[model samples]
Every structure is written in C-alpha cells, then in structure tokens.
Target: MDARASAIAVRDESCVGDEFAPDIPGLKARRFWIRNSGCVIAAALLVTLSSTALLEPLSDVAPPTGPEQKKPVVLARTRRQSVTSPKKARLWMPRTGRPETLDLVERMGDGSMSQTSYFDISLDLNENASGSAASSASAVAQVADTGANPFDLVLQDALDARQLMRHSGLGYAADAPKAVRPADQSNVTVTPAQEAMLVRRIVSLPVQPERLRDIKGVIGVSEQDFAQLASGLGGDVVRKGEQLDLIIGQRPAQPNLSEILFARHLAADGRERLLARCDDGHFQLVTDHRPYDRMVAEALAHQAAEARSGSAQAVPKDVAALQDAAADYPKLIEHLARRNVPVKVSLQIVQLLRANGIHWSKTADVPQLDFVFRTAEQGEQELVSVTLKGKGRDRRFYRYVSDSGKPEFFDDAGRSVSKTLMHKPVSAGQLGDGFGWRVHPILRTRKFHNGVDYRAPMGSPIVAAGDGVVVKIDSETGYGKYIRIQHDGGYTTTYAHIEGTPKGLRVGDHVAQGQVIAYVGSTGLSTGPHLYYELRVGDTYKDPTKAEMPAGTTLRGRALEEFRQQIGRVETIASTIRATATSAAHSAVSALTPGSDKQ
Candidate 1:
C-alpha cells in the first residue's frame, strides 16, 4: 500500500471509541463540588451569624426621641424582687488591719442615702507570712492615715513584690516600703534526725542535672551547706568543670556469722580466725573450737588414767615425765593441724619432739617450725607453692607451667606427680574389646584390631585422654565419624564410632584432658553403641593398658632455681604466723594445766 493510504487507515482505527468516551470537564466539576461543598456552606453561615451578632447590640440603644419615641429592647433580664425584702452584705478587709469602725450605708431606688449603721472589724495576719507583726501593723496604720482601704493596700503590695523584705534590716528606712520576701526565704532549723530523713529523700530523687537544679532552686540552700549535708550522708561533692556532681557511696553490708564461717571453711587457710565486734561492745575471736575441745578432753582422760596406774608404786621423775609427754602428744598434733600445718610435716615434727624428749609443757623449747601452702598470681600466671619445714630443713613444691603450656606440680627433687595420659577417659563404661586379633562382630571374620572399644549406652560422653590438639575430624569408610588428636611426646589418640562431636569442635582446636569431645554411637561396621579408642606412638599402635605412659614434665635449670626461691618466700610468711600461734598456745596450755611453769 502507499504510505499516505496506510496512515489514513491507522487513524480511522484509533478513532473508533472516541464517541463513547465520558466528558472529562463534567466529571472534574462533579468531583470538585463533592470535595468542597461543605466548606462553602459553612463560610456562608459564619458570615450570616457574624452580621446578626453585630446588629443585635444596636437593639439595646434607645431610638431617637422625635415625633415617635421608640422603646429600647432588652436582650435578657432577671426577675424583680419584692421591695420589703432585706439583703445581707459582707465587706472584706486585710487580715493585718487593727480594730476599726466602718459605716454601712443603704441607698433607695432614687439614689438617695437612707440608712447608715456602724460596724467594728478586726483581722489577724497569716502565721505563715514572711512579714512580721510589726511590719504588718505599720502598713495598716499607714493605709488608715491615708484614708485608703487596708485590703487594697495589702493586695497591691502582694501583687507587686516578688520577695518579702526584712523591715528590721539597716538597708531599708523604717517608714519606706521594703522589698517583699517569699515565705520560703525564712531560715529553717533542721535537727539531725530531720537531716538524715532529708538525705534519704534526696538520694531517691532523679540524678539528672536538670532535676537537681530544680531541687536546688526550690530548697534555697547554699552550696557550702549542701556539700556539708552530702558529706554527712556518706557522699562526696565533686566539681566537674563548671558543673557540680554528687557521688553517693553505699557502704557494703557486713557478712553475717554464718556466711563468714562458710567462707572460712572453703578458704585455703581454714585455721584463720576472725576478730568480730559483739553487740555488748566487746571483741572476741570467732573460730570452730569444737575440734580443739575434743582433743583436750581426750588428753585429760589419758593423763588421769596414767596417774591412777602409777599409784601402786613410787613413780620415778623420768617415767612420770615420759607418761605426761605421751598423754599430750595427740593433743599437740591436733593443735599443729589446726594451725594449718600439713599432715606429713606435722608427723615429722612429732618425731622430732619425741627424739628430743621434750614434754608438751616444754613445747616452746622446740625449734621454730614453719609450713605454708599458698596460691599467688604473678602477671597473667597463677602459681601454687607449698613449703614444709621438716627433717631439719625446708622442702618446697611448686606447680609450674611447662613449655607445652601444661601445668605440673614438681617437688624439691624436680619430680612431677601427674601422669601424661589417663588410663580411662570416660567416667562410666565397660571394656569391650582390646587391641589384638578379634572376630569382627558383623563380618564374622577374624581381623587385626588396632584399637580398643568401650561398650556404653548410646549418646554416652567420650572425653579426651590427654591435653592435645585435634588433628583430624572427618568420616571414614569403616570408622564412620571419628576424631583424632595429636598429643606431646610423639603420641596420638583417636576416638571413632562417635555419634557426633560437640558443636564448634574443629581440627586444630586444643582440648584439655577429661574434656567431653564426642558421644558414643554404633556407626560404621559395629555391633552396638561403643567408643573405639586408639593410642599410637609415631604410627605404631600401643596397648593403652599394657604400655607405660610418659610422666609429667620435670623442672630443670632456671625453673628449678626459681622454685627454690619461692620456697624461701613461703617459709618467711609461715614463720611469722607460727611464732604468733606458738605464743597463743603457750598461754592456753598454762591456763589448762594448773601449776604448769611458763616456758
């Protein structure tokens, strides 16, 4: 088709629906009316009401008195009263005014005075007002002399002044009107009890600066007095830049006797006593004395038995002394233990006393004995040290951290007490299979087993045999889900047939000994739920039950030398404590044993 013919055809098709389209202008006009018709009607009604209001006031005016005199229209009026009715009137006056006579006058309808009666009025001033009686009386007298109403004078003064000024002050003349002072400006005398109550109320108030500022404005106290009040309430007033800050310190409550006793029982030095103040205003040592009392009773019974047995013969002085020492030995040992001496050290001390033939009465003659066990923190590390004064010298032990980052306790000879690996890692389980040739439970064939099995209920916890880093964590064909850990001394351990490992456990993560890493399961080629554990030394399997494990790390060189120095420091502290205890013991023994000579 030709270009012009094609354009004409397209235009005809586009105009097919034009005749059926709604009128846009008509729709728009309807919408505009719907949205704003109410506003237009309201505006017209307001204008009409305003015009009626403006014309109504003109009705009250009388019409012009020309040939026709028109009456004035009254919009509203009250009902008339009877002429014989009597009305009572009240007149108000200032409370500060003295007694004075007032004339009550009545006027008739024609505006002429008819009757006049005299009445006396007297008023008293408000007690809460800052204006003194003298100032109030003077103000009233001045108003009377000026022939002005005292009520108006007092009302004007109250409205014009912000604060009530003191009339007796030298700054103002006696006759001149003084500045008014507010009622709150009067000096307030607070007792100690009231001050304490106010302190409590102030502490509970909000600590915001705006809140505190409002309180200060209302209280009208000087900054110095406020500071003194805060100090008495166990608070500090600090000036921060231009702002003042109050810091209230709450005193820590003293622990009760029961709480104190619980703490002492759990403390390292259980023998420590507390000097507590009693309600009767005296101090007494608080300690568990039941154990000491039992020991003393046992000693007394033994002494009496020995004396009765020797009644039949004349006992020699040496024999009697030996019996006395024997009777006191048990009591003395208990006393040493109560003083925080170690059992081993106490035994050595008793042997020393026996060899020297020293009676309990002569305990002060024995060599000064010292023993200490303490945990101390140095920098970021915590160390436990023990010192024993025995066998004529002091022996020490220390828990030191090794190069492998494991802590081990070492004695004076540098020997460690902890073992390298645990024989059994799990708490509750039975040994199922040992490392050797064993018949496979599922396959029904003999196979060389590389590990041992611990039969346990499903989901039983499996712990690490030693402190090590996890080297492997993945599923295997026959082992199923398993984890292998690499320990020191060329040793490695494996835990197989685990249902699942703990969350967040991954390869290269360090695990401590006895830490639960996984749970037991019957995965892979197994019969039931069990833990397959293996121990290897450089790829060679070892029977955990038969093979001798490595001992804990030993201290050498500088480590050993430092341990000896720690022992000396502990001994020094122990010696000071022992000397004090010995003096107290000497006094106690003298009191218990009548006629015993003091050493």
Candidate 2:
C-alpha cells in the first residue's frame, strides 16, 4: 500500500470513534464505501496491522490519563531497539533560537510537567551511569521508542540543583528571592505617648510605707512576703547575655531637720512680722493675744523680779534650807555675787557652806573653784579627788592637762589610762544595734548599717570618744541632732541621735576625751532613746569595738615629772581613806551581829 492511502486510513480510524463522531450518516457512508472497494478494505487492514507492530514496544505503558492526554503530540522517528531494563527516561525538546540549549520535560505521576536544562541532566546522568557504552545506547533507544516516564530522574536533578545552591550559600526559591527580616529585630510597638505614660506611671508610684502598706493589706500577703516585695521594688532587673540579673540600688538620702519640720507643717515663716509698740518704746501687749517679742520681755522682767528677791536672801538661815532651795548651790552663790550681793556676806556664807559638808574651796585667789564629792557606790571608802568634780575619778590617778587643753589621766609611770578611742561614747549606755548588713525595721528591706547603736536613758551625757575638734553640728532625718569630730591619725567619730549639745558647744570647738558633748535622745529613726556612734578611717567605716586604734600619748619631760609628783600624794591619801573606811565597815558589821556585843 502507498503511504498516502496509509495516512488516509489512519486519519479515518482516529475520527471514527462512536462517542466522538460528528455525523453518524456520513460515518456510515464512508464505512460502506470502504467495505465495497477491495483495495480500500485491504489498505485499511494493512495500516491497522503495521500500526500495531510499530506500537507493540509501548504496549506495557499505560495510556496518558487526566490532563496529560490533552497535550499536543509531536511526531518523531524511533529505531527498533532492545534493553534489559531502563531505570528512568525523559522527553527532550529543543530551544527555539538556541540549538545548544535543550529542555528535558517529564510528566509526573500527579500530571505535572517539570522542565530542566538538557545539558545539566546529561552531565548528571553521565556522572551516575554505571553501564557499558552498548548498554547505555540500547537504554536510550528503548526509552525514546516506549516514551517511558522520567519523573524520578527529573526530581533527582531538581533536588541536586537545590542542594548545590544551598552549599554555595545561594538559597533556592520557585520565584524571586525575597528580603528576610532578622530574627533579633524587636516586634514590640511602642509610641512616644505610650512611653511617656509608662514613665509617668513609674514616677508617680508611692514609695513611703504609709502609702504602700495598704497594697500589702489588700493583697493579703504575710509580713515576710511584703518585705520581699519591698526589696524587689528597691532593686533593678538587668539582662546579661541570655540570662537576667537583679541589681540593688543605693538607698535614698534621708531628709534633714528643716525638711522634716516643713513636711509636718511645723516650720515657722522666715519673713519678719510687723511689731506694734507704744510711743514710749514699750511693746503693746494685748490680753487676747501677746506678740512673741512682748511675751519675751515680760518673761525677762519676771525673772529679774525673782532674781532680786533671791539675791537679798543669798545666805540661807540653815544648810538644809539652802540645799532644799538651790539646785546647784555653788552656782547659786556665784550668781548672787554677780548680781551685786555683799562681798562680806558672800564669803561668810561660802565658809559656812564649806563647813557644812560642802567641801567647796578656792585655788588660792583664782576664780576657779574646786568641789569634792563622794560617789554613792564607794561612799567615803574612795578618796575623792580635790581636782576632779564628777564621778568615775580615782585618787590613785593623776590628771594631766595637755598643751592642747585636753585633760587625760595618767598612772605613776605617766602611761595614759584612757584609750586612744573610747569603745563606748556614752558611759552608761548598753550595746544595742551592731554594724553590718541587716533587714531594716522601718523600710522592710535589707540594708547595711554604717554605725553601732548604744541604748541609754534620755538626756544621759554623751562624751567625746577622743580628744578631737568638732567638725559638724547638724541635724538629719536619719541622724537627727548629730556631731562629727575629727581626730588624729585619720580617725573620725560620729555621735548621732542626740538630744542637744552643751550650750557653748559648736563646730570647730575642741572637745577633750570624756568631755560631755551631747545628750542621748530618740531624735532620728530610732526605736527608743539611744546614741548612734560611728567610727571611720578616712571615708571607710569600721566597727568601733573591733577596730585597732592608735596608742594613747605618754607623758614625758616636765609633764611626766609633775604627774609622778602628784601620784605619790594621791596614793597616800587613797590608802588612808581606804583604811579608815574598812575599820568603820567592820564596826558596823559587828554591831549588827547577835554575839558581837558580848565579844
């Protein structure tokens, strides 16, 4: 049969399907004409037989299903070939303008077409090929004839390209690469208004305990938990690396005396007030309300009137009457003389007072008067010093006033009896709070205490720790009325929570060791009347009880000779006084015993 007749027969067969034929009558007429003509019938039979023989190699492959069958078919020549097995195969399409570039297309099982460069696929296949030249050629011919699916081969090439791009640090994508945001970038959105509101919220938070106590009460937390909360508030949180840290901040400074008074509405106006006065230069006093100046003048005049009467009766009728009337007998007498009391009468009264157990005497003609007194503890058993006026004095001890005018006691050898720094500034005070870290009672937070506390009675005398000049006399919220004294060898001592200093005590004034500087009081953040004493070397604080201090000065030269000379007389008097007191005590004990009278 001719090729034209074979082509015609193939076209007729393709167009003659029962479900796809456009005209049934035309199809029937064509079938009748073909059947009647023997040549046409023979040609049709030959075409069918030849087509079946040509497509016999691809009979094992399933027909293209779904969308793949809809693709346009292109005719290609194939050679008869035999292969034991073909692993994968693909359809190759040549590029329009570039003969070197070929597109290898494969239909996936899911009816998707994947296309890749033919050269790339060929190179990969060459690298992976393990068969001989003849076997490879035979495999290619069989693939072209049978149209075998290349899904696996195309997927493997795609995977290789992706891995290569990744290794080269060029990430692969189906479309264009997009700009990726950094993972560390903050996602939080905060505006200026929001930031300002947050700052205001933090600034307006109440810090005082009175204002915050209600929060704990409402939250129903225990005292310990509340204290923990307060400590947390006082601290700050910081981030370091991948972890967080809590940092505690320094405590705020306490308010001063004036600030405290002003907060409590007790501060007086500093502006001067107008005063009303009579033309005669006397302040006009009113019954409803008296001005401050007028009230002060009246008090002075009343005190003058009383002083006049008291001066007239300077010498009391008896010692008992004088003792009952005068708080300080010697001072009262001196005051009378200063108020123009008769000199003769003042001397007579002084001699009479001296005879009546006063023991007051003058040092030759000097104005300095000395007094002798016995302590209730030792009574007359201890020989009271004629020079020392107060308690805590021993007859065996010799007092030496330094060139600096600071008095210190010494033994016969002239070694100082006092320490360089006193461990306790208040003699009668008991140890209370100690130095170091502790949970604050009022603040409910952990804090470091820079000083030690001494508990003593209110108004009890507070003395200097050593011979030093007063540096600061000021009031603070925490320290109240406090005094700082600068001593030798970089040593400084602070006396705090004091009621007041002596009338003449001021900053820059020299205070001697054991000199009464101030009185104990609960003038600061104190639980009771006590003295807060601090010891410092330069700017660093130290525990007063444990700190090693400099050695006390030793008397030498003329001072040493004078101290030794006085020690001998003081020792003799002390021995005589002790012996007499022992004898008297023995007599009293014997009189009290039941069989003593008979003995």
lDDT of 2 at 572: 35
In model 1, the worst 10-residue window by lDDT is 195-204
Clashes of 1: 8
Q: Identify the runs in model 2 with alpha carbons over 4 angstroms from their true place.
A: 1-401, 404-418, 551-599
Candidate 1 residue-wise lDDT at 298: 26
- How far out, in Å, is residue 531 in model 1? 0.4
Candidate 1 versus the native: TM-score? 0.31
Q: For candidate 1, lDDT tens digit of each residue in 1-599?
A: 68797566444533444355345664445445544675788899999989877887787454365898766655454433323324333222222222111111222235433222111111111112323333333333332234332111111122111111111111112224344357633444333321110110011111122222233332333344444333332333212111221211111232111110100011123334323223542334557443232222222222223223432221244223322333445344323322222233333334334422334343232333322232111112122443444346654455556554666556667655444566666667799888999988888899988988888999989888876788999888789889998875468888888899999999989777778999998888778888888889996999875665543444568877766764553343333333323332333333233233222
Residue 351 accuracy (lDDT) in model 1: 38
RMSD of 1: 46.3
Query: Which TM-score value belongs to model 2?
Result: 0.26
Candidate 1 residue runs with Cα over 4 Å from true position? 1-371, 374-396, 400-416, 443-445, 546-599
